[model samples]
Target: MDPEGSRIQDDPYIQVMMAGSTLRKVKSRSWKKNRYFRLLEDGLTIWYKSRWAGRGHSTFSVTDLEAVREGHQSEVLLSIAEEFPAELCFTLVFHGRQGNLDLVAESPDEAQAWIQGVRKLIHKTQTMDEKERLDQWVLDWFHKADKNKDGKMNFKEVKKLLKMMNVEMNEDHALHLFTMADKSESGSLEIEQFVFFYKMLTQRDEVWKVFQDYSEDGEKLMLEELESFLSVEQHEGEQSTQHAQELIECYEPSETAKKQGAMSLDGFQMYLCSQEGSIFKPEHQDLYQDMSQPLSHYFISSSHNTYLLEDQLRGQSSLEAYIQALKRGCRCVEVDCWDGYDEDPVVYHGHTLTSKILFKDVISTLKEYAFRASEFPVILSIENHCSVEQQKVMAQYLRQILGDMLQTTLLDGQVPQQLPSPQELKGKILLKAKKIGGLEEYLDETCTDEVSDEEEMANCDAEMASTEDSPEKKSKAKSKMSRELSDLVVYCKSVHFGGFEHARSHAKCYEISSFSESKAKKLAKEAGTDFVQYNTRQLSRTYPSGLRTDSSNYNPQDMWSMGCQIVALNFQTAGLEMDLNDGLFRQNGCCGYVIKPDFMRDGNTQFSPDKPEEREGYKPLRLSIQVISGQQLPKVNQKEGSIVDPLVRVEIHGVPQDQAKDETSHINNNGFNPVWNETLDFTIHTPELALVRFVVEDYDKASRNDFIGQYTLPFTCIQPGYRHIHLLSKDGTAIPPSSLFVNISISELT
Candidate 1:
């Protein structure tokens, strides 16, 4: 099927977009101006420019855009709603950190036309297969290089196109390939001829050599040979024979090859680039983990200060941040509630310049998106700072807005020794706040009527009570918690942490504790075995320290290694910490929960991150990775006539003894097809807790290296044999065809 729709000419919206229209581009209320916008013939780019500015235009690819929102859904459009009707306004949301574009059409029809048209384009781009996307990318570049309105490109234009594509080719070799592709001898190449030239330039000699090593003949692989390859190289075991037949049927390009039960070079390469050939195992791509275990026996995806979009000090608090976090499979989210105008409660970081958002609006947003990505229960961690009156209002919004989605009662009306599983509590939102009393105390209504100021303020983090303020001043700010709010806390009740032994004796399964990053690290280092044991039966959340005013995150791998269930991170920040968080939750259907390793889930098991070798049945594994080559890597500098000198680094993040990093030598002046063939090996003491990160950077000797792309996955998910590690941008979005081709081998260390 044609990914851009089987029939593009029949759509009216696409037709209107092709014809173009005038829109009022809005950056702010006073910056709105008229601009002419149109979709180019390639159907992958949108160009717009000021009607009065001569020869100055801008263009953005359809692939760069994430979605198009109708009406005034964005903050920029909402700020100007009084000047324009909602129907006449729209917003274009780009991928990653790119700012959104707000536009107002002259009429509602025009607004709807652009909105629906761009949405269709996005859907088509998403549906394109890897091979189809590569072909479209090549064609897009061909169009960019055509220069004139003509449908062909001359040798000079082709040479310029090579630079644009991040390729620094030798003049003689480039001329030879271009002349050979231009078989018509017209001194100019058409689109088809350009594609031929691209193929000749990107021929994978490394892959060809590996293929020749297995094939009886140089051209193709027989059925038995393919089976042997899968068994020996891919570690397919007894299933290799069946997998071989499936590969031949799926990837074999020639009908004759399929009939003869063989695979040609093109077929073999296709098989290698397919999802089956990727580093992550195909089985682990789905929901393979055990979700029926107790809730405490899982590593839950969590976010700290979920309302903030930027720095905690002065960033904007937005409802969209909650929606973004939930959509990214965050099972736990924190909201700090304080008093607001009109006797309502607002969420924001206290003692900071951050903006505030209504508590009711946040609840509404959570209700709409809490289960959109994962059906597992969501824990709403409330840091309450409201007065008694506003606390009542906040409780009312939780019940009214969330309706039946809120888990306000004990499951089966009975308090069990252990908490419920995620599968059992699906489609419910659990409130993690201060409760007046225990579950047994709730049986008597009179005993659980009121919460003291100390109990109420215990849910607040250390930052909430600033050291600059005197004790008397801080006491004056504290307020009592209303009974309505205290009653809403069901499973996840927050309490102050005592010693590990105290928790084991007095803590209930329904109660949880929150620790600052520094405090948690101290406890983990002092009593690692006790921390792991406590987490087996009860949940514990670890959040960033109060000093992280910039909203930075600590390494979550440290907490996960010790069985910390809710290691909340600043979801607004994008870095190695966020990358590892995303990588850990990318498995098990991204349901926001992954079952803890067996030792961590066992109450009596002795497993410490500091002493992994002492664990029962401990067997270390030796991992070997061969960095073969790179393909179509992006250039860091956008300057003209510039190329990147790229290098690949492989890092293992896990137990301290297993932590290691190795890199390949830099390949100068080449971001395309740089061959390393360097093998880096490591001995992993605890493979279950290990994460492997492959990073590609523009190497610089005098200064820090510039990031190109990276990919991280669990060490257990790494598939053996030849594989393609598809790279991602700094913001965690896929940069297709920009990948590292490598071979992997794993075995038990002697």
Candidate 2:
């Protein structure tokens, strides 16, 4: 052993090497037991044995020692206690053989010197590129200094470093240094850290006091105290949330409306006004008042009376039930009509045995019930369930009774001449052609009659053809001809069919026309008729079309554009009951409904209730909706003669309100306005409701607006899930349903 090695004994952890088998003996207070260490081949290999066990316990290869000494071995065993006294017993071994090696000292000055040493050594090793070597050097120094391995330099380490430099620091000053040095958590301080900390110390009185009062003997702060302080702050935030919820639940009436049921309209208005961050203005109050008006002009009287016309004959159809339904606010009604024995029109769904009740009877009944000219212009869709002759007779009777009130091509003054025989009519409803020869002949005769006699004769000879011939030839010729004839008389009206292409080749042609299920909707839109008769199957196929062709298959807007009123035929009471029970009536685009009386009596099915006296309403549901604009606003000073443009309106029904009256609850808040040209967001406030309905209308001519769509917003006051909702409109209403929900969860930490 070298003589100078004996002085290491005083350090209490020195090992003495021995010759013969290359063994060592260690003596120290920390190592109580005798420890053997061996050096073989002139210190080329070293080994140690536990003297108590008399066995070789650990060994060290000199080759590795040489490598580490040469800076080739990446691992650098660091004594953590030198920097962090709290981690005195721990030692961190860094992998230095992989790349650059770093040694972290207690002070920032020492750390800078250590980093410089690492940079110089790495540049000499050629183990990494210039950029990579710099990065490795910085990372290694940070890792050595991060005693807690939290990737941050804390106060204790900084204070210890200052003490070594003969500079004292109080806890606060140490903490400030820790904060400034560890801006990004990595323990080692950068060039900016020293400058920032020094500047802060010079500028702040607190920092200077902390530096002057620094003491190593001062008591260490307990970890529990730090954690408790953080917890208290977080708890206060949670309490605030609970308090807000309580406030909403225990809301009190404002002082302005304390005397009026505690919830007067004025109070509601105030509440709406108090809502800041909203776009609604006070001027929109009228819009809300207007929204309270009835969404539809017609109401079904005796909504629960399924047997209103069970025993009435086809001609003696009574409007007593219809009137009651209207009083209840049904805008549309179903009236069955049949032909009498003498070709008179009668109102009944089934065949009539007597002709006592003429179509005039029903007309008069309607006139009495209607009362005012514009109060409630109800649409009475007549379902033709009897023969074609019966329907034609009924139509004719209706024309005579209704006169101008009846909306038809004839009423519009579009007739070319006198009505044609029923048998000669084709497409849509069966009617007699007043002037035919189709388009070709009509055009020729009407336009050529003014020509000179010579020109007229020349054209007549070339155009003249046989009028009477074999039945097959006549039928074929008739099929090809597209003009009106001079002598043909009215016979039977033709029934329109959706599959007319197929029916023309198979089914016998009739004088009366019935609508085909396939084309009924398209034809109705084009004709602008208020009443359309369709087979039950077609009517039952209430799949939406046009609006969302990608899914709904039907667009209410398209239907509204077509002037035809929709009616379902062959509907049994059971089917109607099913529809009502399933909330089918709530679908948009449906104007009126029809069902055979016999179906109503089969099982005593009743109409669902409309008011509180009725059964519970269906669950609230949402509809996926899309809105479309039908017309553009007129420019300034534009012509006023044209019909006024319609404004979109929405009315919700079946919501539980404070009042028990059968009045509508208008959502007049700016949140419901469609003119904003942006989405209006709001919540529906109601409790345990039976049914939810949406009615849309225009403000100018309220009665003339169409029911573009309807939907039910499902009723679940407090829940976590998705619910679809649709917008409602009477005429040209285009807003789609807005989806809403509440999230009750903590924000995620990045």
Candidate 3:
């Protein structure tokens, strides 16, 4: 995993004996010799004068390497080349960013081997990420622990291995593994055997029992037994059988690579850890949960300060922000409206130097793209700071641009007992600005979401003090809003939570409130049950506080675990937190809404986020996926404008943090149907909690690989088939039809 380390293990093709430092050289200009040379997957190292100490040494990463080949005339290799023999002379030149090193082998074949080997190492070394490092790290551990050098670890080694991995196990269980992993009864466990032991060592006994119960003969389950277990006992669909067959055949190795369907206990263990079957039953997704639960009962994908694309201080605000957010299945979009020239309102960060976009343009863009990506209702969380004239113009723009799609009245006007569902509000946009009722005259677009009394004044002071404004600008800051704009506030009336007891005051369908993450987490801790009960019927939002001004996100699952819907994130940012957000909503058809778990639903039966593992009916999964090949991969953004040395990375993310696994394919020189034919296997104990993402990147030798495209799907939504994964941008937003075609097999292990 070290980018500059020389002693690496994975590639055994180019063998190197421990030679003295007298054979190595660094940056050969005229001549620099008397050094030891060691080459790893990552780089080549030159140590001065036959020593492992750092007194005089230089490491060159593969990314820093320019080339490695036979010596050229007039090069410093002429001097060092004489040390070995005529055939052993090979020179390595470094890129502008790194130092150079030269190596001498014993024979011509060894020299060619080092040349080709170092080039291959560059690709593998530069492409390595945490997952790849883990893979290598495990291999490295296996090698180090094989003290007897029989390619297997003994019973004594097992205890040592467990300690090294930081595992805690009882004596009886350790003995059980000693026998089970010793499959051949050969008195020792090889790499695969140890891997099975590793998987078993980390898994839950209850989960293993569940998986074993699916075995018809109680000894082992092959493809037929698994299909029978799923389709008959589990009542899975007919395709489940196909998935089982495909997975078992893919996982069970055959001499001809055909369908053998032979599965040992270890094979079965790996299957349960994959995505073929979900740990949670389909019920967790509530696919059939009636949309009648009211909009507030579901989790809505929301955005915070949607106008700013970058940082809050100096970013440019554009209408594309709304389009991008909406296209990525964001249900709620925020807009900060300020008075612009000529009776128009503009959207921008209020207290920052961000550029502005016209409010009318944002409205029109929303009207066009609102329901294109997701059919669920769009909640416009407007932080209004416009004049009465501009507020009137804003209202006119909403009505004119949105037409009938804008919701301006209660559903049926009947004072219903429950709020309307997302289904009921389909094709409609709801205004979620503050609704100050009982006012003689409606204020202009000047009410905020929930910046607080003191915070609101501070934001205004910062906004105004940042720049000089005319008298009209000051007047507009305190202008009265038109009543027409206020009328648009139907279901999503942004209110502030007073207390856990008073949060119920907004229990009515239209009086929606919001809480920052700190406030919401506090409420959840102090009144866990009350927090749960409050969200049953009322609509509320939880947003990241201003402290997250850099646009990073808090783990939304923590908020989601408490059943708070409308968890707003800074949609423009990308990372694991965002990946989880995309994963959670990636279910239920990416419709911007997901039915709450029954425990979070009104009149809960028995569901608690803290005890997710104990949640009944949840099952483990075995997923076998073949990353076949990519078709027409878009070139990674580069000035080179080349076809691309493409590679595929398949990742599994979710709960059971340690169970997350990711693998990458070898670099394919072809973009058109580049046949990787690599199988990625995983056993997921928490399928409902896991997400699978495929990232295709263009490989580079001298720098980080440029991202080609990615596509993420909730493990539950993935169906077994020869499917085409239409890729998305790095941000999880849909791109063009450029895709990777792959075969998928999914089976429910328990």
Candidate 4:
């Protein structure tokens, strides 16, 4: 549907909620002000009442906006006859540069319906690419350029349109564009031709620079040059030349059929952005990073409550959450199973309003999507809350669904002093849950001796209460488990981490344990060296605390610093912490595992999170970064004309002992070609622990700044030399070549 023509009444979802009324427009809160909003097919239309509010009206995409229920003062009826809950409003949260908008429904029923309607829209929008979004933006602004309604735009109007897209064209270029777009020599551009011309012109501008960079005498590349470039640089495997030949044929078939051996600018553009030659360079950057390492010697990408999409309470849980996490390269997924309505077990937040999905469905989902995105072994972190019968069903379902993909034996029947590498367990699923009767055999089995039996029982009661205090918990807490489920626990054993001393005790097999952030931090601070030594042999997972009700994530670096193998995060949320997680795990073919630092892997080495690891690579390093041009910088939605004065801020986030902070410079209004021509330098003491994030923001004189896009990566994974940094959206979706072109180098200063 055309965005301009979309109305709320056209949507059946909206019609059911609003009852076919002409009440498409309503009052919503935006940026602390009341704004009139219209529900469009693609997004909500927002406009302020004040005429000079800079941004009079704009559309925020449903893909970037999520409707979440709010519990603050949501009074549907002021003076109610029947008593009701105080809060019933929903906040339209956006996962974009735009701030959140608030909407209140007349009743709780209406609020839920509206939430469902908007959520459906949000899901629909995720499929849309920024390219299509840009097209819509152009169409929205083009009518202004096509004045007098003759369905054509003259050269002057075309020039104005270019400026809106952050393209500055002089008279010579303007006339050339007019001539090219007006293929019939009509002296003006028709709408369809205008769109085609915009796409081609933008593509040309982006690809032309690279063409000039690689071309000699400022022209196209010969077939031999193209083949050499591909074979030597871009292609990963042994068939670079063959792939190059195929690429040339696909893009420059005309020249090839004529027996010419050249690739023009158009051909170059097609080749550069094609799947065969993606600028993001999907190939693994480091050969060593991709090599398999012991599961205990690497940090695994993991998610907490892999079922929940929103908050812990009342959030919708689905198999899609597991799919999303796995798709983003999460290898460890949490599935909290409880007794269901029948023979099948269910997965959800134990005692919350969150919806539940069948345990069989979740296991089947894990089996289907486990290695599809990441080839490494997957660990199903099971939080068991089922009765003996239900637990039997859970085990049965796992065996039935996952089949032989589940790992049932220790590698070679003997637990290695160190855990098996991910390579040894490829395509295997490891169940991580506590075994009921295995502790007596493995006497030194991860039992914490610090607490007495009475204290342990009391603690278990408290834990049960904390998990869920309902009558369901009472029945499930004392349930017996089948020997079959116990047999499935081969590698990932759920054990309580005692003191550091017991962790390094004898006869300890490939047992794994978990700690909340608080407990992990306390243990690390209290026994830093022992923590490091223990991790060398056993794997430890650090999860976010129960206090994170919003599903927000905590920084995994502190846990990583302590050599915790699996620093699990809420993969459903996108923030600085998740950005760091994504960046750290981005290497190694994004197989969801990264080899730990050498010091952390050394069994006898003593290290502390409080200090830099005393290793061979320690040095005072100087990093110099040149802020160069950006490609297709998004327009500022809050501005009058979707314009922006762009700026780049380079931030170094690491330990306090490390070097400088955020350094920024503004290149007023030239978002398309922002150049500081100046290099920002930082001296870091702990180079390995540092994270460098590049944030692009729009400058506002009288108001707070607006975000444009950002790219964050660990210091170790950063590639030097002139390169294009593909940006990600606030929700971590690939924004493609909407990127920064910059030169980076790291030098040892001391």
Instruction: Quote model 2's TM-score.
Output: 0.25
Give per-residue CA lDDT, model 2, range 545-613, as digits (tens).
Answer: 112211212222122122112322211122212222223222221212212222111222221212222
Which candidate ranks first by lDDT, i.e. highest?
Answer: 1
Each model's TM-score, in the order given? 0.96, 0.25, 0.51, 0.69
The per-model lDDT (C-alpha) reads 0.88, 0.29, 0.64, 0.67
TM-score of 3: 0.51
Cα TM-score of candidate 4 = 0.69
Worst 10 residues of 2 by lDDT: 293-302
lDDT of 2 at 746: 19
Top-scoring candidate (TM-score): 1
lDDT of model 1, residue 298: 98
Q: lDDT per residue, candidate 4, 442-493, as tens digits?
A: 4344544233434333323222333324566545444555555766777776
lDDT of 1 by residue, 600-698 (tens): 989997999999999998999999999999998998999989888999999999988888999999998888788999999999999999999999999
| Clashing residue pairs for model 4 | 74-87, 74-88
Better of 1 and 4 by TM-score: 1
Rank list by TM-score: 1, 4, 3, 2
**Candidate 1 displacement at residue 365 in angstroms:** 1.1
Ranking by lDDT: 1, 4, 3, 2
